[model samples]
Target: MAEESGGEKTEQPTPKKLQDAAKKGQIARSKDLGTAVVLIASAASLLIFGKMLAIAVLNIGQRLMRLDQKDIFEPNSMFTAWGDAGRELAAPLSGIFLLILVASFVGNTLLGGFNFSWEAAGPKASKMNPMQGFKRMFGLQALVELIKSILKVAVVVGVAYLLLKLFFMDIMALSLMSEPNNIESALYFLGWLFLGLCASVSIIAVVDAPYQLWNHTKQLKMSLQEIKDEHKNSEGSPETKGRIRRTQMQMSMKRMMQQVPTADVIVTNPTHYAVALKYDQGKFRAPVVVAKGVDEVAMHIRKIANEHKIPVLESPALARSIYYTTKLDHPIPEQLFAAVAQILAYVYQLKMYRKGKGSRPKSLAKDLPIPEDVRH
Candidate 1:
């Protein structure tokens, strides 16, 4: 047996281990990936629908600003105008919210596929433990997260500075241009800055995703002893299984030996093989092999035949053929019919002579008519 200490985890986690972990809501997931994806998607949605959103906001502002004196004084008119403003904002706001929701879902799915686990949602005491909380806050994972956050901020700031330096002339010219032209130039600079930030975050996400998966795998690794215990729990323990097998074999042997008394003759390969055969013209067309065994079981078969006063014969070829070709309680093949018939006839003659009913027949034929194809 392989020995393993609990401290060293050497075995790869089995499928069952992974499945149980999943049931408990333990899975590899990259928060960085999800964050990056949501940021990119939100930026893209704004770029695509920014004009429509601006138009909606402008229309609501214009309606509110154009109210007559009577409309402003009347409480009913004020309420109606507020309701109109809400209705105008609803479609644009809902579209942006739905886009963010879908982007977050897609981002999470890309990292760990879809997983629904009630265990993750349920409250646990461990989460409230101060020591555990402290460990989590100051652990290697926390350190890695801190480094990532610093790197992301640094990269974004550096990129923004470079972008502003490259567009310094254009930016200064914006002051000399009209208001509309200045707004357009500012929007263009913001778009490029957002894209640069998204690109940097995406690079971090790509690296972090694989690292999270590797760390999860390492956490789930098992020791050799754990693997063996899991196997014993899933399948039965080896010692118990061995006992069951031995008991079954003993019962089978008892049944086989009981059938020996009914056999007409027990043929043997002198010491190695034993085959018990019986035939009745009115019942079986061919001789039936009642029992068969090898070595120790063969010796036991011969001992039972002697106690029952049943005839025993030495015919290695016939014994091997019957043992190999016939199953217990099944008829021998047609090829061995002639050889078995001769053995049965000789045994019957010997019984009759011993009872003083007739003289003994000639010695049984040594070269029984066994077919070449059926020989073991």
Candidate 2:
């Protein structure tokens, strides 16, 4: 017969993985929409806020003229006036800018888990293939741009229509309010308009950025085969894992047998399994398995019990139960309570007999006896 040979396998990307990649900004960012929206918002805010500030400055100047009883319109004072206006507006503008920055950060994080990092922003190798370049130029990324454009247009038109309906009357009545007291009213209307516009624009900017980001991530979901391949790549082949597990079990068995000499008793399946247990008064109310093993290791455990003169008893059920349920230097579980109680009773009887106090108690005789195999 001829020997068979294995062939190499190739790994492929899954739809889910591709979708996730898209979400991570592997697809292009809708920079045009994002930039235009930010610029429009910043301009609108500055214009609306600047108008309100100008009205406040005028009102303040009128009050100052009444108090000082002088022409406060001197050229030298004009520079001071501009400085005062700027200083008065500084705090509000600073607060507004801070809010904008925070909103931008939150929007980005929600969309793609993206945070500003210098490394990712840096330049790297360029793709050399013409087909790859064409794909990059007009692929899913182009679709993202088209969607962003449509969304931006819809939002802008909606906001404009609402603003016209709500604030057109306010704009017309601005000059009709002439009293100095009405100055406050005029400024209040402007503030309301500014807030309404900001609230509207911010809603679009925040929503679309994250929505696109989420869509991108959805595109990167991994298929089952991709997940398996990734596992193999990261954890090595399954055969290697099995070998590692077997090696670990062997090491554990060696360590388990090494602790057998300290055991007070060795419970056994004669030649197949061994579980060595120990107890110290006032320390352990229940006995602890000091060592346990099977096959060659089981034989080594029995040999250690013999050398240490620890009594070994053949109880197939007890031996198998302890081996399967308990681990080295750990207490046996509750289900084997009666079986373990019998083993300990036998051990105690053997100790008493060796001390020459008396014969084995009737209770101990009825239970399994400790092995004559070990002296201690």
Candidate 3:
């Protein structure tokens, strides 16, 4: 006898498995989270170091061109220095910029699954169906976008105003001095202000980016009813389900009777029911249900048990209880504990008697009492 045994082998990953992965730190954030982190970092780096980087380039290019001391400060020479510096810095700076951009794009794509669908970019037929179009026109998503745009404008304007005020403070301090080293002092203050603005703007980007990403993902969750409808559509109707269940039961019965040769005993209703129990000292703490059957299945169970030289006993109540409650490879329930204990004791006594050791059973045998509520 053989069952369709494939169901046990194809294990499904349950929700608990996902939770365990998270608990073990095996989970990772989506690509959006990585993109947001990189963007905020880049914005900060540019804001703070832009002036310092420009000054460094200007100094290097002036030395390389060997500009005269007087010509260095002249308007024509200053414009030439700027153009030369930009040209000289282009290779290293452009390479760095391209690297950062590529890294950010790759990191974000990995964190977030590839969301390359064009339909997600704008309104579509399915999304516009009936009342959905009205909802989309005045939805929370639209409101959030409006707020984000307003906040971005406000932040940029405020940072610019603060930078101007800082510039004035540096200028006023310079005026109080007898001989102001104009270019050096101006560049130093500009560098400081640039760094400050960059730091502040980045703080804003860091907070806003993740919030926007989270809200976007939340809109993609499927509804419960949608899951149920998919399951029914993929499987079949109720009648087809019942037929599959009955076929599975028949296959299970065939496999169960095949294990009877390995059983130690069969407790039975003599005709209508059978339950085969197997036990070994240290192998099991109690008897295990190796097989069970009713009607035609019972006849097969009993026939196999007889052929295998295993003991078969008529115990209608125990057989029925085992059939209803104990599955193959499971222990009998607590309510049937006493009855099973008596059967085990009797079998052990018969083995001792056959060995010609004293026919007397263990004193603990008195402790085993059959339950009164057991029905025949």
Error in Å for residue 14 of model 1: 1.7
CA RMSD, predictions in order: 7.5, 7.8, 12.4
Across residues 57-107, which tens digit of lDDT does each residue of candidate 2 receive?
665576446533344546566566567767776765775576567655544
For each of the candidates, give the backbone clash count: 0, 15, 5
Candidate scoring better on TM-score of 1 and 3? 1
Q: Is candidate 2 or candidate 3 better by TM-score?
A: 2
Please tell me which predicted candidate would have the highest lDDT against the true structure: 1
| Ten-residue stretch with the least lDDT total in model 1 | 179-188
TM-scores, one per candidate: 0.60, 0.62, 0.48
lDDT of candidate 1 over 1-376, digit per residue (tens): 2343664797789999988998889988999899889888777766655555666666777878886988867879877878988888787677767888999999998966889899988999999999999999999999999998898888778877887788788878878976444555555556566766787788889989999999999999998778878989988888889998999999998999999999999999989999998888899988888889999999999999999999999999999999999998899999998999899999999999999998988987788999999999
Error of 1 at 74 (Å): 4.7
lDDT value for candidate 3? Answer: 0.65
Off by over 4 Å in 1: 1-7, 166-192, 239-376
CA lDDT of each prediction against the hidden true structure: 0.86, 0.65, 0.65
Greater lDDT among 1 and 2 belongs to 1
